[model samples]
Target: MQDITDVAKRLVQHNKGKITEVYFVACGGSLVDMYVSDYFIRSESTTITSGWYTANEFVHATPKRLGKNSVVIACSHGGNTPETVEAARIAKAAGAQTVGLTYNDKADLLAVSDYSFLYEWGDETRVHNNPMAIMLELTVGMVNELEGYDHYNTFMEGMKLIDTIVASAEKQVEPRAKAFADAYKDEEMFYVMASGASYGHAYGFSICSLMEMQWLDATAVHTGEFFHGPLEITDENTPFILAMGLGRTRELDERVLKFLKRYAKKIEVVDAKELGLDMIDDSVSEYFNPVLFYSVLSKYRYALSKVHNHDLDVRRYMGKVEY
Candidate 1:
């Protein structure tokens, strides 16, 4: 596999000053994975605009600005998601530079994209090579090349610790994860909450882990938007899972935690600060919080699958039925 940074460098070099916008398009968990990149580019890049879109919607309502000056990063784990493939094709047709990330070398998404990256999966020691990490590297690489990020080396240093961080966090959260699964096995629904970079973790856990895998109803609520509407659903018996991050927006998660502690009896928090987020420099710690949060919370989902007697791989309609 080509080095992700090298891939990013080539892409940025090819476009240089001509690139003005980036669009991230995917579906399901892949779409959720794009959240961090979308957030990072918007926060770091002054010259570039970014958008995150569900693949199907992106196809139906292609952006007017998606032309020669645009770069579209599309992902599919297996590289065969129809909408994502179509989205990549459309972006290519519109003269936008397309980048595809997938775990499969033979993925259809690679055909339409100008650059292709194969991210590592199912390997604990190679956690740094996961899809999200690859996207982060690509984003940071682009920003560093375009506008010069002072903390670029810090970000690179943090990547080396990803495997250790994920392993340590998984070990630390194991007991809590087992306890949570035992306690919540009978629960019918859950509300997951987080803010900033960690929000994508919440969204993926809610939809992919709980709803799709366990057949339980789940909703992901943004901590910043909780009081506006979602807080009304909270009560002593309501089950809630909160992912807290150590980022600039940590205050938003703190506020939600305070409220949840006050009124919600069933609350579980996966805090990045508690899971060794300090191992990375403060300047770039927030960008890595999602990785820590996702790794630890995955333990909970595994335990839940066991206690609920629902195999995580079991699905009713996905891939087996037409929508």
Candidate 2:
């Protein structure tokens, strides 16, 4: 397997000044993973435009900005997501530079991309190994190269402390995960809330873990939009899981938290600030908060699985039938 770092360096070197926009294409967990990358590039770069899109949408309504100077990044965990593969093919045909990241080297998406990075992760048990961090580093590394951010190396150095951080986060979330699982293992429904960097965690956890893995009904609602419609559905008995991160957007999450406290009877807040990320440098903590926040909250999946007597790998329609 090629080191993703080497592929990242090559990608940065080849397209440093030529690329104008980044189009992230994928579906489901793959799409959610790229959200942080899209957010990071837009937050840091002055000239570069970045957007993440679901594969099917990207195919039907291709962005006008996508062209030879754009970079399209496509990823699929199984490497066989039909829409993602087609999206990569379309992007490549449009003369855009295409990069593929997936756990499977043989994935159809890789075949259509210009450069590919394959990393082996068995059964996807560890959230830290989800490739979101690697893709985030790659996108940020490009920003550092082009915009003189110069934080890429420092961020990479800080990432060396990730194991320590994840361990601490795990310890903190373990009790909460168990507590939530013990309380709501048999509950009929759940709604997750997050905003900004932590939003992907909420979306991914609600759909991937709760709905798909645990076979439960779950909805992911952005905190900023909670009051627009979702808030009305809240009641004393409604279960709300809030994944909060420390960043400029923390205030948005806090607003939702305040309302949930006032109305909802069961509000479980998994705060990234509560986790020991003091080991991480303040300069990069905000950018990496999603990784940290999700690393902790992913524990709840396991706890819920165990408490509910459902195996996390159990699925009904994912691989069982054609969609």
Candidate 3:
């Protein structure tokens, strides 16, 4: 695997003073991973503008600003997601610096992208090599080189602990996850909510894990948008999974949690604060909490799969029939 930071530094050196905007494009779970990077860049970079787009939409309605001075980071875990590959191709055609992240070195995304980084998946010891971590490394590295990020060193320090952090979180949350699966095994629908960077966790878990994998209906609700309309759906019998992160937007999640605690009976709160998030520096901890949250959620997802006798890989419509 190529060193993501070195690739990012090289990109910064090549594009020096010209890079102004970045677009993260992908679909489904990959898109959710990009959302975390998009959020990180927006929060940390002062000079760079960022956008997150679904791969197909990006290919069709390409941004006018996506040109030589822009960077587009596209991800597809298997490296063959058609829309993502096309998005990378389109971005390159628009003269944008394209970087592709995937677990496959032979992935088509690598062919279209200027730089390709192979990330590790399903490896407990190499958790830092995951897509989200790779993307964050690229973002942090680029930002540090382009415009001196204050917490660059701290972020690097935090990355060193990622594997341990993730492993500890998985162990800590295992019992809770089993209990959750057993309790919600027969539930037909669920609402997953979170704020800040952790929102991606909720979105991915709700859609990919619960809905697609388990054949259950699930909706992801942003805690910040809860009271606007989603709150009305809350009732004593409604099942909800709330992810609370140690980020700036945690209060937003807490506010929603308070309401859920009162009105909702079946609610599971996955708080990163309790999941070894504090092991990292506070400045960069929020960005890393999503990884911890995902680790915890994966255990729950697996447990649920067992309880429902539904294998996570078994899908009804996806890849079974042509769309």
Note the clash tally of each candidate: 0, 0, 0
Pairs in steric clash, model 3: none
The TM-score values for the models, in the order shown, are: 0.97, 0.91, 0.98
- The local distance difference test score of each candidate is 0.89, 0.81, 0.89
How would you encode candidate 2's per-residue C-alpha lDDT over 137-237 as one tens digit per residue? 77876677666675667788767777677777888778888988999877979999888877887898888888888888999999999979888998999
Give me the runs in candidate 2 sitting further than 4 Å from their true place. 1-9, 12-16, 122-129
Tens-digit lDDT string for candidate 1 (201-274): 89999999899999999999999999999999889999999998987999999998999899989999888888
Q: Any runs in candidate 3 off by more than 4 Å, and if so which?
A: 123-125
lDDT: worst 10-residue window of model 3: 119-128
Give one digit per residue, the lDDT tens place, for model 3 in 50-161.
Answer: 9999999998898889899889999998999999999999999988999999888789999998898888777444878888888988888888889999998899999999
Model 1 spans with C-alpha error above 4 angstroms? 123-125
